[model samples]
Target: MKALTASSLTGLALLALTGCGESVSNRLMAPTDGPSATKAGTPIMRGLTSSAGVVPTAYDGNTSGDGSSSCSALGFGSTGTKVDGAYSQKVGGYQFTVSGSEKQYLAFAPSGTPTSTILAVIVKGGDAYDVYNYRNNPRTSDAGLTSPYNHGGNIPTISHYVVCYGPYTPPIFTKTLVGVMKEGATIGSMEDDLSWRDHPDLVIIPWGRTRWLDWQLSYTLPPGVTGIITENATTVCGSLGTFRLQCTFNENPATYPIYTWSGLSGQGAVLVMNDLGGGGAGSCGDHDYTNTATLALSNGTTLTASKTITVRVVCPTTP
Candidate 1:
């Protein structure tokens, strides 16, 4: 296979994904540094519509979700540069900042500590683009997409994404390990560090205009787990047997921790101790948890772990 270069397709002018357009591989959609393709067209934003014709702006600090009361419009040039709407404001204690003199992006975040977990946008003149929604401590490649090419893995480098026209379908922005809060650090921060890049305009077609972008911050992610086991006791030490084990962590406090079991004994045999992962606590402190492991021995003998576990396994019938 040919080596995929991030820079080659980063500026491919928003070509169509079907027919003559290049189709990306599945690897690109799963967080792999795979190859990418670009379409040849200017980026464009969509317009939202409501029964009232258009969304009206108010002098007082108030914004409406109705399409007639709020709308954003975008235009693009052949050179893939944006021509209008590059300003932002606040509503309901939330901050909206838009960027992209050429191809704009919109970023929204809470004001205080300043961290953006979700990013959305329309490519001013183009129809296709990428939106990266991240969590508090966003990690590289944690973003999602609805590009012509659905490449996953860590979020792609910003420069690699196309700001071209679209007849596009984007997925709902989900929480990643990082977010727009890091849009400003440096080129490296976008791909390495967790600094926000310039908080750009997102593509929320509020009202009848593609002019306004909305990033709701009430969403969060549940913490993930870490750790696994190799095999069970009933199986031969060197024999091929399925070992069952799992561990989890909770990132979002709102969601409680839940556990599932896997192994020869089937499901629900094992329990996820609250003491173990701390129910997704502040420090994720010491993992002093407990659980039972059962291994069915073919031979009339018992097996034990090198590290003493909470419970012992009962030997099955001797061969």
Candidate 2:
């Protein structure tokens, strides 16, 4: 983040007062008295496909039947007891059954590619239900269910199922300020540096007033800088009101150059960075700054974006 010199400010004020056209560089280079207004755009939902075909496997919850208690207390069934081995069915080439006493189970056959990745599953019923990744680590089992019971009156039946891989690298943006005006306005266009490893699962739903998703932002300061003032603009929907999101960021003396915002959805779903730093001033420094934004779904699928920015301040000299 760069600051404008006294001379530059004087010239900018003159141009504005005289109704003269301003250059883009001048607009971006201008110092902001406060944070800038959010740029609005439609939120995107991307789809993901498995690297290879996967076959479903059967996981019986009855410890006596399988001689393994790994799923003893993990099923959500009518009797509230572990599912009987007979509770097996096939749907869309995937095997589905009850596991433990409170969880549903699905199994995927081995694939040629053995790379590690997160799997997201959705079990739809009267209301959409998201499955949980009980095994937190990257898995090859390809089978699991929601952590808690859907508890939709009757045994929650699988209305729909979808899977995708995750824990992806986020997109980064870097822009050189060449113009300015007052603070809290559009500075300039940003150059995107997209660096990611995996594809995020696509989630499509009808647009509604209720907030089906939530997010938070975090800031990282550079080394040696301290006592910096920071503020987060209240999160709100975009003007289009069609699944758009917006927020603000500010730091006095602007120490923290990097910030990240992440989101999570569904029941018992724990994303790595969810709701951090409710927005306030804090100590920061002059170091490589990184910002992260993550979105998680009810079926245990997560999407993340991380940006690292290097702050280079070039103040103008007074002539």
**Candidate achieving the largest TM-score:** 2
Q: Write the per-residue lDDT of candidate 2 for residues 1-319, one digit (tens) a residue.
A: 8899988986775455333222323222211221221113211111111222221221211122221222222231111112233244442233445454433344453243323233433333323233333223333344444321221212244433434433222212221111111212244433211211121111111122111112223223112111111122232111112212222333222533333233311112222211111111221111233334444332233334443432211223349
Compute the lDDT of residue 10 as modeled in candidate 2: 62
Q: Which candidate achieves the best lDDT against the true structure?
A: 2
Model 1's alpha-carbon lDDT is 0.23
Evaluate candidate 1 by giving its C-alpha RMSD to the native, one decimal: 26.5
TM-score of each: 0.19, 0.21
CA RMSD for every model?
26.5, 30.7
Tens digit per residue, CA lDDT, model 1, 73-188? 11221211121334454422235454444223344444442222221122122222332322221221111122222222121112212122211111111211122221224553
Give the range where candidate 1 is weakest over 10 consecutive residues by summed lDDT.
54-63
Q: Rate the local accuracy (lDDT) of all candidates.
A: 0.23, 0.28
